[model samples]
Target: MSKEGRNANGIETLAAETLQRVMEHPATQNDIATVETQLGRYPRGMVAVGARCVGDGTPLVVITGPVLPGGIPFPTTMYLTSPEAVKAVSHLEADGLMRQYNEMLADDTNLRAQYERAHAAYLAFRHGLAERLNESEEHIEGISAGGMPVRVKCLHALVAQSLVMGPGVNPIGDMALERMRNEFDPTVCRCVRAQSDGQETR
Candidate 1:
């Protein structure tokens, strides 16, 4: 298959996986509440829980709608909500991992191609979500979060996409996750609050 064909197939697979996740784990009020606690505010435009903590089932990442309630365009689809995960990625960003990834992308053509494909897949996935929500994609067309295709701006955004879409979809995200393996393990529950208790106290 040609590169375009492969890209299209990748996009379709990702879109299908996202929709299936939505079907299987539809967002609940409790999930919103938990995410709000994790984020220290109510999550806006969240459509579904993209990924949950393997340890305690807390929402680790959320899938936001393409447009907000008032028709505001939101380009970020996958948002990291786990406090532990956020802190780990934030530490990596503080250590200048993004600059290293950017430098790597500048030197490696193959990596650049993969990053471009990831960007395309992100756009496709967002568009699919927009269609599902009956929202316009005009405002955020060709726009994806995390400084994809050219730069590594936000490790948190990239890592969120990686956790939601799984590894190999975003190489930079995979790298970030790998680098932070010691600090953040999704398999182990690192959530500060015990979600099972249903207590709002943090």
Candidate 2:
């Protein structure tokens, strides 16, 4: 498990499991349609680089964890030590979430429920899907807005697959840590790994 008590892969697992829940739950289509319609209305650039959606009707579910944005090196990067290094990487995702959330909050202002529900769904799926993946408890994002609550729904990863988007660490050895920064790319298949039992939905 990564620092902040979460599994490294918890995020993706959450999305997948949540999609499954959505399918089983009565709100599947409506929720998905709303998200899709918004996505379609959204400029292609926005959705491709920054949007993330989950839930499809077929017997398949795909958890899509968005590496939406944010990646600033701590001012003292070179001299950074162990726990510090860990914390730096650990909180990276949380930092990204807020970057997006703050922007969303400005417009929605009162949409805390939406964010919380999304987070709760994310957490639930993380736990449930862990059992499915046979992976040690993994943390999706080490931190989320530090604290927030929303509707909670768990996904069933054992019943779904996962798709992630992010960057690649090439042998540009010099670009080592630099390569870890977020690079939003819709067409780019960030991570295409599949579930053993679940179909290769991604």
Candidate 3:
């Protein structure tokens, strides 16, 4: 779709377009270096670096290609690569927050509707990505990350999507981030040096 046409589809479409343009661009040497240093290895099928640190503008999350090796369709579009963020999310997950979020989704109708919309938007974006990349969308069609549109599963995936797509895109992600404010605050710079080596995360 043309950029102008996508703009007319509303915020979700605009976010998809922004992500599409990022996906089309090749990963720069600097991007590769920082991500590799942060991850301790080379990242595969990395389409674009999405959200960055508010303090330093360093890349935190990334949008990955729909398909990877062995003809596998990757369901998680946005990946949280930041160790600090990952740690924070892990803590939340360990706290059994997914069960609580799932209960919330079951109890509230409006929240469920919003989550369903998020699922649709996520699928639309991924399908567009598949078309742009010349990959088959059959396996991942209608599939979105974090058990969206039904239940809460992975806060990390949801949070990554929320961070990349901006606020109001993923309700569960927004809620999870809100709950874990003390553990992780994107506004502050948490990019510390890796304990194994002296290299900075970003």
Candidate 4:
């Protein structure tokens, strides 16, 4: 089907357009180096910087290809790379927030519908990325990260999606992010590297 037809069919054309822009620009060597430090390993199949920190403008989320270089299937598209963000989200998970989110999803009909939409958008975005890369999407078809459309499994994945797609894309992610504002604020540069660099410059 044509791109327009696919958009009309409820595929997130806006996300596809954003993916195109990201592909056109690509990530810099500095971005890769920083992400390596943040993740403690080289990120595989990284496409571009999906989102940046509001304060220091460092890479916050990465957009990865649907398949790795070795032809391994990777369904996760938006990956959170910042250590502070990861730690904050991990704290939330440790606090049993996922159980609360699952309960909310069970009771709130509107929230469930919103989460379902988020899942569909995630799938569309992953398929769009795969198509752009000319990679096969068969292995990860219908699979979205964050246990979407049914339950809240991972706040890290959900928050990554929210950061990349912006607010309102993932309701549970938005909620998680809101709750973690006291712990981690994206608008503030709480990155360990950023703090270390500040100390050295002083």
Best by lDDT: 1
Candidate with better lDDT, 1 vs 4 = 1
Tens-place lDDT per residue, model 4, 115-143, is 98889889878887888789898898898
> Cα RMSD (Å) between model 1 and the true structure?
2.3
Tens digit of lDDT per residue, candidate 2, span 51-166?
A: 23222222112232222124221111011111212232335444453344445545563465344443444355444433543434323443322233421111111001111212
lDDT of the structure predicted as candidate 4: 0.84
Clashes of 3: 0
Candidate closer to the true structure by lDDT (higher is better), 1 or 3: 1
Better of 3 and 4 by lDDT: 4
- lDDT tens string, model 3, 56-116? 7667887677888667778888788888888999999999999999999999998997787
Q: List runs of model 2 lying over 4 Å from the truth.
A: 1-110, 133-183, 188-202
TM-score of each: 0.92, 0.26, 0.84, 0.88
Can you tell me which runs of candidate 4 are displaced by over 4 Å?
1-11, 194-202
Ranking, TM-score, top scorer first: 1, 4, 3, 2
In angstroms, the error of model 3 at 36 is 2.6
- Candidate 1, 1-202: lDDT as tens digits: 6978977896788867766776476789989988988887789999899888898898999999888888898988889998889999999989988889999999999999889888887887887787777889898888899998788888888999888888888999999899999988778877788454445445
Reference-based TM-score, model 2: 0.26
lDDT of each: 0.85, 0.30, 0.78, 0.84
